[model samples]
Target: MKIKNITTFLLKVPLGDQRFYSSQCAFPERNSLLVRIETDTGICGWGESGQYGPGEPVATFIETVLKPRLIGKNPLDINVLWEDMFTGIRDFGRKTTGIEAMSGIDIALWDIAGKFYDKPVYELLGGAFRKKVLGYATGCYYRGEDVLDYKKSLQNLKDEASGYIDAGFTALKIKVGLLHVKEEMERIAAIREAVGNDIILMVDANHAYNFHTAKRIGKFLEEMNVHFFEEPVVPENIHGYKTLRETLNLAIAAGENEFTRFGYLELLKNECLDIIQPNIGCAGGFTEAKRIEALASAYHVQVIPHCWGSGIALAAALQYCATIAPSPHTAFECAPENSPMIEYDKNVNPLRDSLLTETFNVNDGFVQIPDGPGLGVEINMSVLKKHLTKT
Candidate 1:
C-alpha cells in the first residue's frame, strides 16, 4: 500500500510539577510532536519525534516542509525516505527544527511499515530476541524548591527506592551531581542499604559538573558500588569523558542529547562511554538510532536508551529495546516507577496515562514487548483531542 497522507499533531500535555522531576531547565512545559501516517490500505501508524525542540513551531515545519515530500511516497522505503529527509535538510543545520521534523516523519514511516506488514515494529527490525525487557526506576530527583535537603532527601530516596523494589524493580536510578559530593555519597549509601546488594543502582548527573568534580564524584560512586554514572559532564566534552573514564572504574554513560549517527560515531570512536543512551525520539528517531546501536555494537558498548518523555516515547523506546538481541551491546532497560513497567510518568502528564487504549503494564520489574502492529499500542483519539494543543 502507498502512503496516502502524513499529519502532525503538536500536543501540549500538562505534566504538573512532578515530585521526582524539576521540569527540564530548557523546556519547563513538555510539548510533544506526534506523527500519524495513513496509507491507502486503510492502515494507520504512529510515531513520536522530539517534543521539546519546536515548542509548537514543529507543526509548521512538518506541514510545510515534510508533508510535501512525504505525501505520495512509499512508507516502507524507510532508509531512502530517511536519507531524502536528511540530505534535503543538511544545509539547514543538523540538530535544529529541520532534523526534529525529519525525526517525526521518519518514526511515522517505521510505524506505517510495521502496520503494513501486520507485525510489530520490533519484529520488522528483527524479531524479538526477548519477549520482555527488564526495567530500572529513574525518578530519584531532588524535591522541594531549595535543593533536595541532604538528609531528608536521602531518606526520601530510600523510601521511594524501597517502594520500587517492593513493586518488583530489580534496579533503580537516581539523579545526582546537583548535591555536594559528601552529601551525595551519604544518599547513595542510604539507597544501597535500603535496596540491599542484589538490586542494581545507577546515578545520573545530567552533565552538571566539570571533569574534575566528575572524577572526584566518580571515585566516590565507585566506592559505593554504583552501577554507572550518566552525563557527568556536558556531552560535547570528549576530553572530559576520556579523563573521567580513565580516572574512574565505574561505567560511564551519556548521549540522550546527541542527534544522529554522525553524532554517535564520535562517542564510539573515542571509547569514552561504557554505555550509550540514545533517546529514540531525539536521536534521529528509530532509523538513525538503529544505526547508532549498530555502531555501538561494533565498539562493544551497551545501549540503555534514554526515555524521559510521555507514553508514546516510552512505547517507541520499548519497541527499540525489544529488537536489540542479547548481544554485548545491551546492558538493561530503564523502567520508570510512576506507572506500570514503562517510563511511568509519576507526574500529571495527560498523554502519559490517559492517551493510550492500553498502557504498558510492568510486572515483576519487566515489561512485555508489544505484539500489536506498529508501535504496538493504539493511540486514544478521544484523549488526544482533549489534550491536543490548539495554538
Candidate 2:
C-alpha cells in the first residue's frame, strides 16, 4: 500500500509527587511521542518515539522533516525508507532524535506489514519462539522528596518490592546509586529481605559508576545474589564495560542508550556484556532491534528489552519478546533459566497503563503477546486526546 500521511501525537501524564528516581535524575512526569501512519489502502499502524523529556520537538521533526519525503512511497519498503530517513539527517551525524524518529517510522511500517499479511508482528519476523513472556518489575525507585533519607527510602522500596511480588512479578529491577554505597547496599538488602530468596533482584546503576566503584558495588550485589547489574558504567566507555564484564561474575547488562545494530556489534565483538538490554523504541525499533537480537543470538547473549513508555511502546516490546528465541538453541521452554523477561515498568504512568481499551497487565509473572494482526495496539483516541499536550 502507498503511504498517504503521517501524524504524531505528543502525550504527557503527571506522576504526582511520587518521583521516579534513578542515578542521574528524578522524573515527576512521563512523556511520549506517538507516530501514526495511514496508507492508501486504509491501513493504519502505530509506533512510539522517545521524547520522554521534550515531546514537541520530536513530533515537529516527524512532521516538518519526515512527512514530505514519505508521502506516496510504498509502505513496504522499510529498509529503503529507513535509509532515506538517515540521508535526511546526515548533516546531524547520528543524533538521537533522528535515530529515535527513524525507530518510530520503522516500527509503524513493520506493524503495517504484519496487518497486510494478516499476522501478528512476531509471526512476520519468524513465528513466535514463545506466545507469552515473563516480566520483571522496574518500579523500585526513590519515592521520597529527600532521596538520601535512607531509612524512609529503604522502607518505601521494601513496600514496593512486596507490591511487585503481589502483582505477580518474579523478577524486579531497582534503581541504585542515588545515595551512598552503604545506604544503597542497605536498600538492596531490605528489598531482598522483603521479597525473600526465590524472587530475582536486579540492580540498575544507570551508568553511575567507574571501574572501581562499579566493581565494589557489583561485589556487594553478588553477595546478595542479585540477578544482574545494569549500566554500571557509561555506554561510551567500551574499556570500562570490558573491565567490568571481566571483573564481575554477575550478569553485565547494558545497551538501552545504544543506538543501532552497528553500535551493538561493537559491544558483542568484544564480549562486553552477558545480557544486552536494548529498548525496542530507542535502539532503532523492530528492524534494528531484530538485527541486534540476531547478533546477540549468535553470541548466546540474552535480550531483555528495556521497555519504558506508553502502551504503544509496551505493545511493540511485547511483540519483540514473543519472537526472540529463548537463549541457547532457538526455542522457549518454561525453565528456571536465563531467558528473555519483559522489563515491565511498574512506575506510575497512566499513559502506558490505561491509554488502551485492551491494556497489558502482568499475570502470574508473564504477559501474553498480542495475538491480533499487527502489533495489536488499539488505543482509545479519547484517552489519547485527554493526555495530548497542546503544542
How many Å off is the CA of 358 in candidate 1? 0.8
What are the TM-scores, per candidate, against the unseen true structure? 0.90, 0.96
Estimate, for each residue in 1-391, the C-alpha lDDT of model 2 and write its tens digit: 7999998888887877766688898787888888989999999988998644577767777788887889999998988998888777878836577778888888899899989998989988888877788888897777777777879666777888999899888989998987888888888899899999999889999899888999999999999998889999898989989888898878899998888888899999998998898887777888889989999988878888888898889899999988877777534365225568888888887888789878775689988888888998788999899989853
Report each candidate's C-alpha RMSD, comma-separated, in the order given.
Answer: 3.7, 1.7
How accurate locally, in lDDT, is each candidate? 0.75, 0.85
**Each candidate's clash count:** 2, 0
Q: How big is the positional error of residue 366 in model 1, measured in Å on the Cα after superposition?
A: 0.7
Worst 10 residues of 2 by lDDT: 329-338
Which candidate gets the maximum lDDT versus the true structure?
2
